[model samples]
Target: MGGRVLGYGTYHVLTHLTSTELYSHCELVRNKLVPLK
Candidate 1:
């Protein structure tokens, strides 16, 4: 039970990190593809 909980926590943290990284990457690409004022 503890192991499962730990696994879930780790997965959630990693997912959060990945989501932020992906969003940053998308922003960079969008800046290159689209002009922003």
Candidate 2:
């Protein structure tokens, strides 16, 4: 019902936020590393 839809929406938002945070962390680490050919 409506509650189930809300729960799913919240879950999706959390999942997206987690992935975005992970991606930013990875980018940060990469920026700190020395580049090689």
Judged by TM-score, which candidate is best? 2
Off by over 4 Å in 1: none
TM-score (C-alpha) between model 1 and the true structure = 0.80
Against the reference, the lDDT scores of all candidates come to 0.96, 0.93
Error of 1 at 11 (Å): 0.3
- Candidate 2 lDDT over residue span 14-33, tens digit each: 99999999999999888878
lDDT for predicted candidate 1 compared with the true structure = 0.96
Candidate 1, residues 1-37: lDDT per residue as tens digits?
9999999999999999999999999999999888754
Clashing pairs in 1: none
Report the Cα lDDT for residue 9, model 1: 100
